[model samples]
Target: MDTSASPLSQEDFEEIARAAARTNESVRLEFLDGKIREKAVPDGYHGRIIEWLTKVCLQARPELWLYGDQGLHVEAYRRGNARPDGCLARSGAFEGAGEWASTEDVEMVVEVTSRDRDTNQRDRVDKSAAYAAAAIPVYLLVDRGNQSVKVHSEPEGGRYAKVNEVAFGKSVSLPEPVGFELDTAPLLGWVG
Candidate 1:
């Protein structure tokens, strides 16, 4: 392969992602504009956090449904397809949808920061931009690096207006739709 020679075309990038996904069920691919990124295979602690968060949301509101690693279609950017760690949407949000749900159908997007610093920042920075650009309403970031949770909301001009944060042991209140306090205690022991 010619190193640093040419940029990958959209079709080529999508194909590469497709091929990787075919063989690895754990692979979650994201296409932002013309850039492609893959999510790291989560550890047991990460899985537990995802499950716990989902359970909390669902248990509080039986009418809503939370999906793990659900595809989000961001029409604000070209070739934008994000697979969020957890996607909480109103019931029947994906009833007639394909593999992805449009931003309008989403209530909140959850991301559990990985062990890698770069990966964690990507979730906090890159993914934050993508979701805000789509006006997806809410972006919840669970930071394992600092054992804290950040909730970003009020999207405008490719950014979020409000950012609320709290330590792992504290409870963070989620806005409407998922109106409830998220207990972060269970996530404390898994912090990096």
Candidate 2:
């Protein structure tokens, strides 16, 4: 759970995305096959989920490196890149100079649902597909809107074939990339 308060500035990669996305709006842009997807700033609940998920990630043994706002490359999926709300990767995966991590560098990706249909759709469908397409072992979706946590696994044909969904008070197990039994009970109060 090594977190940072480093100010968010437009790094070279972001600059390239800005130029590539062809927009000046203050929205997060994801590049995929020369097309850009816009993601608005998350609201309070979404932000809190990032903090909470990071906390859970850090508690796991053999501590993997955690990231809150880092972008992961899914170039296998038409040169795509996604910034999950929280992510865990094997240590030293980012040793060299690189703004984005390749799919293989990541263990799992987390996405907290934002308050909108578009964001919900992207988190559940688009991003999931991209992650699966890139063969990321785990994809966790925190649906504050639905009051549940959905864990997708067994990537196959651009989608995860296995899924385990549970409500806030229940628990979900994250395998492989993250071998942890994440308790969602604490989220009940905040999620409500």
Candidate 3:
């Protein structure tokens, strides 16, 4: 898919959508929409980690929003939407009415990868460029398959300077945008 096409005017795309829907009954349409759709899955270790992280974030700083499994569009980039496993952002960054976020309005984005063996690249590669392009300040990735928590900061021109990684028992400090340290102990312990 081309990820660089300039956005078409709303009218132009709506016409196309209407025509396509007229012929196809199986197509579910979503465009510039802010609704989220997630597959149901058993609550596993990854989910537990996210839950713990969310609690820690709230306890440490209750004013920020803690979001999970929701789409965010940061820039006008024509890339596939990104859904962070868990995230923290201040309130009122975007249209404050729905389950999705305008990527441009987010400050921190986190992704927790499960045991989907073949789809891990979606976290490491695709989201890396997409988040950087959106200029999101911090990106925290929890890779259960690898037993690591990778942190990316200082995004410059569609990339982040690879900085820190916390394994099962370690913790890392995020100083910019927010002041909180995440201890990986709870996360690692949740694994088993």
Candidate 4:
């Protein structure tokens, strides 16, 4: 795929996304690496996993909040737009921002894989690159397909320098900026 030449410009994509949102509330669109893709409307288990993470984050860091399905401007020069499953930042970080908020205040971004064909490319690969390029401190991916959690950190030159993976039952430490240890044991129940 030639990422350099996208079919729709950034502005065009944003307008289409807004229209899609207004017309069909369930349809979510994302633009990454010069391609437009539909983000799957999460299922029951997916919602539960996000809810579980929200509780843990609130308990560990009362000062921060995890905003669900928050739209964000990502990738180099904010060229890509993504709606992360959870975006962790100081409370009210995006108070006045519109549908697509800058990644400046985002400490960490999380993606819980949906049961769809695009899961592997969208969540595991493209999103990681986009968040890292936008310089988000952490990118936590709960990959249901692999039954594992992948923590990508240390962004440098548009990519994460470190990526650590652990199975569903294991505990993983989400690094600094979003300092906390995640107990992923409950994730076993959330996957099909």
Q: Order the candidates by lDDT, highest first — what do you get?
A: 4, 1, 2, 3
38-138: candidate 2 lDDT, tens digit per residue: 66678777777788777678777455766776777787765676778877886666677365767677888888887766776678888888889999899
lDDT of 4 by residue, 52-143 (tens): 99999999999999999889988483488999999999999999998889899999999999889989888988998899999999999999
Q: Of 3 and 4, which scores higher on TM-score? A: 4
Number of clashes found in candidate 2: 0
Alpha-carbon runs more than 4 Å astray in model 1: 1-13
**Model 2: worst 10 consecutive residues (lDDT sum):** 1-10
Ten residues in sequence with the least summed lDDT for candidate 1? 1-10
Candidate 1, residues 43-145, lDDT tens digits: the string is 9888988888878988898788878877777758654778888888877888767666677878899999887655754788888988989988889999888
Candidate with top lDDT is 4
Runs of candidate 2 exceeding 4 Å displacement: 1-16, 19-26, 32-34
TM-scores for every predicted model: 0.88, 0.82, 0.73, 0.95
Best by the TM-score measure: 4
RMSD each, Å: 2.7, 7.8, 5.8, 1.8
Candidate 4's displacement at residue 84, Å, is 0.5
Q: Candidate 3: deviation at residue 68, Å? A: 1.5
The count of backbone overlaps in candidate 4 is 0
